[model samples]
Target: MVRSGAGESMRQPVRREERDRGEAAGGGNRSGGLVGWRPRVLEHKVRPADLRAVGEVRRELRQLLSRWREPAGEDLTEIATLLTSELVTNALVHAKGGALVRATVTDRLRVEVRDFAARRPEPRAATADGTSGRGLMLVCSLADAWGVRSHAVGKSVWFELGGGPA
Candidate 1:
């Protein structure tokens, strides 16, 4: 929770309000006379091989939404939770090494799951009675936007849920 440059630690909402009007609104972890602030973030490290990874990520997602200034709704939360579960499960089930889960709150909520696996995610049709292979479908249906990005060490699968008028 420590600020990146300074030694001060930061919690959710990522702001400091002054009792007087002079020092309430600062920029980049400093006290100044600005008006508003944004960019709330939450991150967690995960063990991809562990059985509890998916559920653990979903719980953290819930916790992250709780700190938002204006959350979308329970419906969006449910979809986002399901999306988180899908992406995290994909990392644990298919990817190598551990994973990192990050949730950023802005005009939209962006959830990114990173793992060392290089295999890209592809969607496959699932049968009515077939009880598997529907993760990406659910993500595509529920998320407003989604894509995968490759990095040297691993890849990141991310989805965004818009926080519009709900």
Candidate 2:
């Protein structure tokens, strides 16, 4: 057995015939087990004020989450989409600076929207003439857990949906 540069023993000896065939085929065997096994980390940045960008974010997130082993069928997807839309919309409407949406999938899916606004979001009663003010309510109803965190520069409103079918 010959040792490679990394001091690992080669599993097999290369014969001259095999080498000629490999050279003819323009290929070489890499003596390593699963050389590329990097873990995946998904992170995205977006300006929440741009409605088109927000929609794109949602679409990308849905695609990413759908590939994962989530047990909650459409319920998780619906809740994530609705809450993300509302949070991003609220940030665009109320926050001073733009918002950043970050999504991560572990045992559960967590969506966080950060904006440069010190004021915490509160649900208000919509009047008869009101056309809005129900976003937070919808978020609360759909998400397993939702809340806001205040920071010196801004705040991040985050929500989580547990894994598994609804």
Residue-level lDDT of model 2, residues 60-119, one tens digit each, is: 777877776434478678778888888888888898678888886655676788999888
Q: Count the backbone clashes (under 3 Å) in each candidate.
A: 0, 4
lDDT for position 21 in model 2: 75
Best by TM-score: 1
Clashing pairs in 2: 71-164, 71-165, 72-164, 72-165
At residue 89, what lDDT does model 2 achieve? 86
List candidate 1 stretches off by more than 4 Å: 1-36, 164-166
- Model 1 score (lDDT): 0.77
lDDT (0 to 1) per candidate? 0.77, 0.72
Q: Where's the lowest-lDDT run of ten residues in candidate 2?
A: 31-40
